[model samples]
Target: MTSVTARTEREVTRGRTRRSLVRRETWISAVVLLLPAVVLLLLLRIIPTVTAMAEAVPLGGERSPWSNFAYIFSDPSFLNSVWVTLLFSVIVNPIQIALALALAVLLTKHIPAVGLWRTFILLPIAVPQAVSAIIWLVMLRPDGPLNGLASAIGLPTVPWLTEPGWALISIVIVCSWVGVGYWMTFLVTGIKEIPSSLYEASALDGANGWRQFWSITLPGLRRPLLFVLVADTVSNFLVFAPVRILTQGGPQGGTDLLMHNISERAYTLGDTQAASAATLVLVAIVIVVVTIQFRMLPGKED
Candidate 1:
């Protein structure tokens, strides 16, 4: 009996030793696989952010270390850019999300050639934003195809990229055209993940389409919707290519978003310090907005 007990103990010891070696090997493999991505993120994102923050600080000779920030706040152009960016965010985010959600629902239904339709919608995403902006630039010209079509339809000509108000609206249109399809793809994935059994069960209980959407679809989509909202808000806030290529901050700074404003200050006016300060402000705004979104749309604990 004693010999049997010793044999059992030895077997247990061997099992644990083998398990420990396997666990160590797994960790080493994980680190090796992740190392390249970690290095790239540090080089691309962290280093640039640190450099921007360092550049934003005023030199020792200044009356205050926050001179750059003060200057930016005092500037009317910067203030206008902030207001414009806020307005753009408010308008563009909802439009993109709503359209994307609608398309996701429609495309996910039992429709013919759904994959082809999805590809057509997502084709814009394959095109670079700068190129898309340039294409829209021509399309929005006073004598361009859009206005020509308007004339043919007996409608008045619209100053798409020429006027301040219309320029902002034109930017919104261009952005939405590209963003809606991209966002829809994510929502489609989210919708697909929801179990079909829920729909079937709800149908048996006589729950209609709208009821099922309200009860199951929305609840199932909570996490993906939250992600889409946060990501869309951030991307809209960082909008520059469309504004730069189409309007160049526009006829009277009407479409001068914060990113374009920063570029103008840094590249056009040679104010790197102010640009860096504005970059920090933009980062702060994104952080605050994302925090609020997380609080408002808290994900369910698993």
Candidate 2:
């Protein structure tokens, strides 16, 4: 009896050892599979960012980093560019999110030709941003179709791209039009992920559509909404192409964004150090905004 018991104990110990070995092998395999992505991120993103930060620290030669940063701060125009970027991010991000949410809610319902509507909405995203900006620029021209329609209705032609006040507004309108559909896609996906049973329960409780959305849909969508908020803020802050192709930060620098200013300084003025410094400042602003967003997000304990 004692000998039999000893043999059974040995077998159980061996099985445990095998299970341990299998777990280790699985963990190692996962790490190996993830290695390529980790390496790519380091090579493409981390290394370049570190290099940029290093380049931003001047070595006391021509265009010293300190002098470059000082120049940006000292110039009233550059300071205005910073303010413009902040204003754009603040205004565009929330408005885009709200509009996208509204559109997503509308399209996700039992509407007719839903697929066609979604396709049309998302078609703008398929077009290159630069191309879209150019198309809008043409449409907003003083003698373009929009103005022609306005004139036919006895309304004066508004200088969409030529006036300082209207220039920024025109850029914002184009940016929102191009971006809202893309953002709506994310919200639609988020909304669809919600369980149908929850909606049924809310209906049984005599809850209206808006109340159900506020309680059920919004809670389930918190994470995705947070993600969209951060991403939109980053994208808006780095806005450049529209300003570059549409207005060239013109109409007296009304549409001058930080990225446009940086590009002009780096490529046109040949001020690499200054551009690097400006880029660093942009990065810092993004970090701060993201941090604040994360901190303010609900479910912090979780």
Candidate 3:
């Protein structure tokens, strides 16, 4: 009996040691897989951010960077970029979120040809952003197919990309076209994760479709909505490609986005310090905006 007890104890000890060895191996493999991504993020995001702040401070520079912020603020071109960026954000974020929500709801239904519809909606997202912008740029030109169709349909020819106001609006449209479908994917996933029982219970309570959406859908989607809002805002804030490729910030600087403004300051005019300062400012704006979004959204319990 004693020998049997000792044998049992030995088996238990061997099992625990084997399990510990396996767990250590798993953790080592995870770290090995993650090391490259961690290093890349540090190099690409963190290092650049810190370097930009440092460059903007002007510790050993000839001219005082004390005026760098003042320079960016006082400059008319920079101010216009700020205005353009804000306007774009205000218009595009809501449009994308609303359309994404609507599409997500529709896609969740048992409709005919639903798979095809989802595919078409998601086609834009599969295309690269720069490629999408170029495609839209071509479509919006005066001699483009869009105007041709407009003329053929007896509608008035619209200036999609030329005029100052229209150019900004065009940029918003282009960004929304690519962003809406991408955001819809998240909303749809969130909506589906909501248990079907909740909707059935609400239905049994005599709540209509609209009521269920308001009570069940909206409350359940709080987290995804917050994510989409903040992400869309950040993306639109950093909008550069449309302004660069299509309008070149033209029609009297109408589409001079903040990123373009920073690039011009740094590369075109050889003002790295000012550019760095503008970058820092842009980062600050993004941080504040995202923080506000988080605060405004309903918490998990709510």
Candidate 4:
């Protein structure tokens, strides 16, 4: 009896060793196959980032990257542009996220023509940002369709692009309209991944649609929500096209975003060092925002 027990233990141990060996072998093979992808990413992304960082830090008789950064703070216009970028992100991010969440919930219902509705919502993603900006620019012209409709209704044809105060709001409206659909798709996909069993159980417990969404759906969608928040924040901060096409960062640089300012400084003003420093600051700000977002998320502590 003792000998038989010892043999059984030995067999179990050997079987475990074989499984572990197989897993290691499989992992090694996978890594080997992934080597080319790793190399490509390093070359394309990592190398350029390092180069940019190096360019941002000027050394010796050359305009140091630090000086370039200082210049941004010293220039009142640049400081105003930074503030504008922040305000734009703060105003647009929550509104866009809320609209997207609401639309996701609406579309997930068994509404008529649901497929068509989804297709329409997703169509904007296929439209290029530049093209969308141009289309909005045309529509917001002084005598464009919007003004025509306003005139027909005996309402004022407000100066959307020409007025300084209204210009930023116009850009924001266009940005939100173009962006909401894309973010809504993410939320819709997240909601679809939730198990129907959870909803069925909630129904059995007398939970209504809103309750189920708040308790079950929202918790399950935490990761997707985090992803959207980070992405939308970064994208909105880097907004340039609508400003360029619609307002051109005017009538008094009200809509001049960091990217637009950086581009103008680099190309138009021939100050590559200053532009590189500004670009680095923008990158750093995005990283900090994303980090804070992730840290504040519920499960991030775990």
Question: Which candidate leads in lDDT?
Answer: 1
Give residue 117's lDDT in candidate 1 (0 to 100). 99
Note the Cα lDDT for every prediction shown: 0.93, 0.88, 0.89, 0.87
Q: Which digits, one per residue and each the tens of the lDDT, describe model 2 over residues 1-302? A: 99999999999999999999999999999999999999999999999888777777867577655776787799887898888888777778888999999898899899999989998988888889999998998899989989999999999899999998788888888889888999999999999999999999989999999998899988888978988888988888888889999899988888899999999999999988778888999999999999999988885445
Candidate 3 worst ten-residue window by lDDT:
58-67
For TM-score, candidate 3 versus 4, the one ahead is 3
Can you rank all candidates by lDDT, best first? 1, 3, 2, 4
Q: List the residue pairs that clash in candidate 2.
A: none
Q: Flag regions of model 2 displaced more than 4 Å.
A: 1-43, 59-65, 300-302
* Model 4, span 1-302: residue lDDT tens: 99999999999999999999999999999999999999999999999878777777767755553876788779987888888888888888999999899898899888999979988977876788899899989889999999999999999998988887788888888888888889999999999999989999999999999899899989988988998998999889888888888887888888988989999988999887778778888998889988898888886644
lDDT, candidate 1, 1-302, per-residue tens: 99999999999999999999999999999999999999999999999999898889856764688888989999999999999999999899999999999899899999999999999999998899999999999999998999999999999999998889899999999999999999999999999999999999999999998898899988898988998999999999999899989989988999999999999999999999899999999999999989999998866786
Model 4 ranges with Cα > 4 A deviation: 1-40, 62-65, 300-302
Instruction: Rank candidates by TM-score, best first.
Output: 1, 3, 2, 4
Best by TM-score: 1
Give the clash count for each candidate.
0, 0, 0, 2
lDDT (Cα, 0-100) at 167 in candidate 1: 90
Which pairs of residues clash in candidate 1, taking residues 3 or more apart in a chain or in different chains? none
- C-alpha displacement of 36 in model 3, angstroms? 4.0
Q: List where candidate 1 sits over 4 angstroms from the true fold.
A: 1-40
List the pairs of residues colliding in candidate 4: 58-64, 58-65
Give the C-alpha lDDT of model 2: 0.88
